[model samples]
Target: MVATTAPPPVERVAPQPPWAAGLSDVTASDASLRRFLHGLPGVDQVGAEARATMLATRSIKTVAKAWAIDLAITMIDLTTLEGQDTPGKVRALCAKAMRPDPSDPTVPRVAAVCVYPDMVPMAVQTLSGSGVRVASVATAFPSGRASLAVKLADTRDAVTAGADEIDMVIDRGAFLSGRYMQVHEEIVAVREACGNAHLKVILETGELVTYDNARRASWLAMLAGGDFIKTSTGKISPAATLPVTLVMLEAVRDFRDTTGRQVGVKPAGGIRTAKDAIKHLVLVNETAGDDWLDPDWFRIGASSLLNDLLMQRTKMATGRYSGPDYFTLD
Candidate 1:
């Protein structure tokens, strides 16, 4: 029975890169570190609603200023309903809303206007003179369930339509099924399709159903060359929780530590009130530090949120409350 052929030499998989190793550590230890991580203290825990109200009122003067500044820097990404956002409508809205008045220097322009692929050209043309970017949701947005060819074509078309940023949704179904490689490859392919446009991979954490999954998705997206990792699609309920944001920001921080590459984070959906916005800002500051607090690294995707923020700011600057229609929206 003698001469069994020698087994072919085994191929060794390369060791994890430093960045990968660091991310692994961050995700691995997140559970234990949960209590220490930054988050909002419970208002209910203050013994009574009346006491909480008193405490909240005392902080209003200080918090109002911070809220105003943060609001001014917010990027309202409007992934509007198809027919609701006609080219003429988008153009008029951009023209009126994005113009910076010298007298209102405190009101910073929004970072970008995010829209669907069909509306990208309109946004690009409308936002051309203004410094605001035209972002398109591509790669089967809200649910990235499509053939690779279809997804790639979608991404290519969005970039061709003058999208400065491509917000592509990841294959959550694959990721949830434990098909991490498939998810990673898809992100890489879409990122490649983006060309010069920045790639913002939407994890849609609401569907991930677990904080661990969100962190893993965040790491995988960043590893596969995502310029930013965003939260929800705004179509889902229970969107953009503080714990989820904490986990994603930690992923960004860890990825930066490992690879020296900085990635942005966006928390979208259901983030309407000014207090909620400030809490997000506080989370970003405490977790990702001051550097990530800028519009480049952070954004809040909201339609109603901006108006509330503008109202709060108007109240602070002029010491009086403004009506719901303070900032016109066409």
Candidate 2:
């Protein structure tokens, strides 16, 4: 067989890294990107899980638990991405997001309502004037299987529809195959498509196969100007577990320290109850500090999590569990 040759390198300029007075872009080329990502510290998987478990098990005082329940409500990206989702369903979800508990007006609205790109107009119309943002998943969500032009069009359409945020998935195939520049440029291009909207870069960590890849993907997303480095697309198994989130929390915490720009961390999928949400809040506080505890700096992407949070909030106030009839179906 004839000798094979690698593809020619693409010339790209990554968004400038957050820097102090005397620094410059460190990941301007493919070789430097590989060096930079590879050079970052590796994760201790067993230790990370052990610590995540230990932190998850920590108990909060009754008073603090009540506070956490509400905070989690405020951070939820109330989502509905089913194939059969209709305009009426999107409107209903928006209504739930704005009020959460119809009888108890004290319950705060969610941070945003996450939906597919096609449903953005309905979401925007329904959530208008309410503080809840409309977040659309783009870049061939769940699979990240599409061309750059398609992904850019996906992002722009959502933004034009008045989506306040765009959740974009990175090309995990390129990432896993070690084509770092390909993945980086896609994120940069999508970030531009987002325009005034915030960009949440979904790593879909379950496909990444290792904690090291998750950590590297986090740094890569942050360096590429992702306003948030999210853990998953909420479409795969093992989505948003505590251990995976712990590694991401550490990555964001350290990234902020190095660059002085704090990027958010969101763990989507598989988080379905009040207890699980609280555990993540504790993890964020203990691992990333209280600075990340706010809705502005952190978000939980889920479909059923809001109902549980409302139920728990009611239980806290009434000292009894609210039956299934108390809340609408997710």
Candidate 3:
């Protein structure tokens, strides 16, 4: 792992917004930050896992299933973040986001298309006026091992390229080392660099190792100005598991109750099939309540989830099981 110096503590130089009411009230001292984070509710691992398992068994049929499929389509952050990503691929992803299914204009488009910083312009150009926003994963995504300056610049570049949202990875090393203040400062800096774009802080929970750490990371990100707290970068194993997501959901639910600020949650990676998608919805409805069921408060970061949803929707409509050839190769 790469070593880098932690940035200085973030001072409340900028005025806090109305939504930042509770978070801004907390002192920036390391001791205070640690006290607040560690003092939050502890996760009952067995209870959480059992709840997730029970929720996954929820059954929906006919119209409700169809509605869920459509809702899932709208919440997708259709993503393609790869070293081999090109302009053509971005444009294709944009196209898929816009229409999703060519034969069905009635299908609602996805929430946004997620890509790397360099591809932001191509995505912006292609998605312009389509009502589909462009989201870029920045701040040395997946690893987030770069210096603070590099990470902020990476975020700024994507915003300058017209990205509507920024998904940034937190330095797991800092979090694991108990540098709560440092991790908080990094998120605040990236949130500032984002300008008007929404900031989705990627906790990369797979690397965090424990439910307690994931809960702590979720609160840390939200308190530091994350509009959304995402589970993974979709680049690691054990990404976006039901139990892990349940922990994040509980965190958001508790945060909203105390802060009146509703931060979104995105469970990226390992989510496929209509059944899996609907189960997530069930989890959302049951845990976070109906308010979080909207796309504004929840998202699924996936590359192939849209195709599966399309196939299921087609199946529901035509009463026929359509093969993979039916949908676009996004």
Indicate the worst ten consecutive residues by lDDT in candidate 1.
32-41
Candidate 2: tens digits of C-alpha lDDT, residues 138-213: 8888798999999999899899989999999999999999999899899999999899999999999999989999
> Candidate 3: which stretches are off by over 4 Å?
1-25
Which of candidates 1 and 3 reaches a greater lDDT? 3
| RMSD (CA, Å), each prediction | 13.8, 10.6, 9.2
Model 3 pairs whose backbones collide = none
- The lDDT, on a scale of 0 to 1, for candidate 2 is 0.88
lDDT of 3 by residue, 1-330 (tens): 001221332332343334334565564699878877777667899999999999898677777787889999999999998899989999999999999999999999999999999999999999999999899999998899899999999999999999999999999999999998899999988888898999999999899999999999999999898999999999999899999999999888877766678999999998988788889988887777767888899999998888999999998889898999877786
Report how far residue 180 has shifted in candidate 1, in Å: 0.7
The weakest ten consecutive residues by lDDT in model 3 span 1-10
Candidate 2 TM-score versus the reference = 0.92
| Clash pairs for candidate 1 | none
lDDT of 1: 0.72
Per-residue lDDT for 40-135 in model 1, tens only?
122232233243233333233445455535554555564454547788767765654475322366676777887889888888888887888888
**What is the Cα-based TM-score of model 3?**
0.92
TM-score sort, best first: 2, 3, 1
Q: What's the C-alpha lDDT at position 302 in model 3?
A: 92
